[model samples]
Target: MNLTLRARRIAAIVLLGVAVTVTLLGVLLMIAAGTEDAAIEGHTGRADADVVSVTAGRTLVRFHTPDGGEHLPSVGVLYPDQLEEGQVVRVEYDTRNPDLVRVAGRGATLTILPVVTTLLAVWAVVSALVWWLRKPGPLHLRKLRPRRIAV
Candidate 1:
C-alpha cells in the first residue's frame, strides 16, 4: 500500500496516542493500588467479610463494622484471586476510608500481574496493527513477467 506522507503521519500519531493511553491506564491501576495500601497501612480495620459473590475475575464481600453497620464496598474486594462465594475471609480495610479494602495480607503486589498482562496484550495487538499498516505491498504483476524460453 502506498500511503501519503500525511496519512503516515496521522497513523503514527494515532498509534502513539493509543500506546500512551494504554500505558497511562496501567500506571493508574498500579498507583491506585499503592494509594489504597497506604491508606490501609495508616489506619487499618479488620473484619470477617462474607463472600457474597465470586465471578471469573472478581469477588464481592459484605461485612459489618464495629458500630454494627453493614457495609459493602462499591468496587468489591481487592486481591480476590482465590476467594469463593459463601466463604468467610478476613479482610483489612482503611478505617478512615472504609471503602478501601483488600483480603488480609494482600497488597499492591497483587496488581502487578494483571497490569503487566494487560499491557502485554494491548501492545501485542497494537504492534500487529502497526506492522500491518506499515508493511510494503506485494510487487505488481507487471513487475513479474514470466521468463522467455531459452533457445
Candidate 2:
C-alpha cells in the first residue's frame, strides 16, 4: 500500500475510535440523568424556589425546607430550562439530600432529545470522514512499487 493510503486508513480508524468514545459518554449522561430523577422521586420534597441566577450550564436557586433551613444547591438544579433570574418556580428535591433538585414537572425524559441528537450528529460526521478516507483513490495512488537496482 502507498504511504498516503496507509496514513488515511490510520486516520479513519482513529476517528472511529473517537466516535465510539463519544457515544459511550452520551449513554452515560442519559443514565446519570435517569438516576437523579429516581432519587428525587423516592424522597420528594416540594418548595417554591427563587431563581437566583441562570447560566448556560445551571440554574441556581434558593429554597427553604420545612425546617426553616435554606438551601442553595452547589451544583444547581437539574432540567432547569427556561428559568430566569429572580423568577419564582416550583421545585422538587430529595429531602434526604437537599442538593439534589430539579424543576418541577421535568424529568430524565427531557435529556433524551439532546443526547440522541448529539450522538447522531457525531456519527454522521464520522461516517462521512471514514467513507472518504477508505474510498479508493486513483490507480496510481493505490500502490507504489520500488525501483529495482542492479547489484
TM-score of each: 0.77, 0.88
lDDT (Cα, tens digit) per residue for candidate 2, span 22-118 = 9999999999999999999999999999999898878899999999999999899998888899999999999999999999999999999999999
Write down the lDDT that model 2 would get: 0.94
> For model 1, what is the error of residue 40's alpha carbon versus the real structure, in angstroms, after optimal superposition?
0.9
Worst 10 residues of 1 by lDDT: 133-142
Q: For candidate 1, report its TM-score.
A: 0.77
After superposition, candidate 2 runs with Cα above 4 Å error: 138-151
lDDT of 1 by residue, 22-94 (tens): 9899999999999989999999999999999988756889988898878888789988977888999999998
> Among these predicted structures, which one has the highest TM-score?
2
Give every collision pair in model 1.
none
User: RMSD of model 1, in Å?
Assistant: 4.6
Worst 10 residues of 2 by lDDT: 135-144
* Candidate 2 similarity to native, TM-score: 0.88
